[model samples]
Target: MTLTINTDVIRRLRDALLAEAATGAGAQDAHPHRDAALARVAPFAETMYLVMIADGRSAPQEIAAVRGAVRLLTRDLLEDADLDRLLDACAAAASERGAEVMLQVLGGRLCANRGDRETAFTLAAAVALADDEVTDSERALVGDVAEWYGVSSKRARELLGAMQSTG
Candidate 1:
C-alpha cells in the first residue's frame, strides 16, 4: 500500500500531543517563548530533507513529500523563497559536511524542547516512509534522529507504527 502523509496523519499526531499536554503528562511551560530556531520552518524542513535524501536519492516524489510536510508542520509559514533557500542549503550541506553532520548540528539546536524533539522525529519518519518503503539507510537515519532528539525507542516505534498503520 502506498503511504501518503496528508492532513489526517498530521491531525492525529497533533491531537495525541495536545491530549498529552492537556493531561499535564507532557506539559511544557504554559507561556514558553517561541525561539526563532524553534518557530521558523527552515530548520524543520532541513531535517526532513536530510531524511528524504537519506536513501541516497532525492526522487521528485520525496522532494514533493517533504515540501508538503513542511507546509503542514509550519502551518504554511514556509514561503516559496524559504523553500528555495532550504533546498539550496540542504544540497550545499549534504555535499559539504553530510547528513550526519547536519543532523548533529540540528539536534543540538532542537533538543532543548521535548515537544520539538518528538515533532522532528515524527516528521522525519513521515518523510522516510513517504514513498511506500523505507530503505535501509533511511531507516537507520530515522533511528539516529530518534536517538539524537532524545526520543525513547519505544516512542519512536509507536510513532512509526502509527504512520505505517495509517498508510
Candidate 2:
C-alpha cells in the first residue's frame, strides 16, 4: 500500500485548531484570574525575548533555552507555537515602539511586587547566559531589566547567585 498525504485536510484542521485557540483566548477578560496570570506571564516572557536579542541577534540555542524556561515557568500552558507567536508579537512591538519603550511597558506589568520584580530580573539574567557566554551587550540589557523592575543591586546579586548555583 502506498501512503497518501492530503494537504487540504491538514490545512483545514490547522485552521480549525487555530480558531478554537483564538476563541478560548478571546474569553480571557471574562476570567480575571487567567487574565491576571497572563498579564504577569506576558512581561516575563517578553523580557526573555528582549534579552535573547540583546546582542543584536538571537541564537537558536538562546531561543530554545528561553522557550524551555517559559514552558517550565508556566507549567507548559504555552505551547511552542504560542511561544513563537509571543516572540513575534514582542519583535513587532519592539520595532514599532522601540526596545526601550517595550521594556518600559513590560516592566510595568510585573505585578508591582518585589518578588515578581526579582524573579523577572533573575530569569532575564539567566536568559542572558543562555548561550553559555554572556556578551557585554546582553549583560547590560540584563542590568537594565533589573533596574527597570526596581530590583535592588543586592537582591539582583542574590538572585544571580542562586541562578548560578542551580544552573
Candidate 3:
C-alpha cells in the first residue's frame, strides 16, 4: 500500500487546528486569551510540519485530526499565569530547540497545573509519543521534569510506560 503525503494538506491541517483553537464552540466574538495563547505556539508551527514529515506516511485527514485535537487540548489545559509562562517559554524555546521543546514545556505546565507530578509526566511523555516515537533525550527530559514535579522515579517510569503503550 502506498500512502500519498502532500505538504499542502499538512499545512491546511495546521491552519485548521489553529483556527479551531482560535474560535470557541459557540461563541463568535473570539477568545482573546486563547488567541494570544495560540499566538505563542505560532512560532513553533514548524513543529507540526516536522511531526508530519517524521511520520513518513500520513493521510491528510489524520494530520487534520491530530492538529485539531492538539489545539483543543492545549487551549483547554492552560490558563492564567500558567498559560502566559507556557506561551513565553514556547516562544523562546521555538527559537532554540524548536517545537518539540515547546511540547515538553507545555507538558511541564500541565503537570504543574494538575499538581499531580506523575500525571503531568505521563501527559508529557504521551505528547512526545504523538508522532509515534519518543527520543531518548525527550524521555530523559520528561523524567527529569517528573522528578522535579515530585514524582517518584519508579512511578515516573511506570507512568511513561503506560502512557506510551496506550498512546
Q: Which structure among the candidates has the greatest lDDT?
A: 1
For model 3 the TM-score comes to 0.40
lDDT of 2 by residue, 87-125 (tens): 788788777886688778777877378787777776676
Candidates 1 and 2, the one with greater lDDT = 1
Residue 68, model 3: Cα distance from true site in angstroms: 5.7
Clash pairs, model 3 backbone: none
* lDDT to native, each model: 0.64, 0.62, 0.44
lDDT of 1: 0.64
Candidate number of the best TM-score: 2
lDDT of 2 at 85: 71
Residue-wise C-alpha lDDT for candidate 1, range 10-108, written one tens digit per residue: 445534433332332211332232234234666677788888888888866566666666556544444555556677877888789888788888889
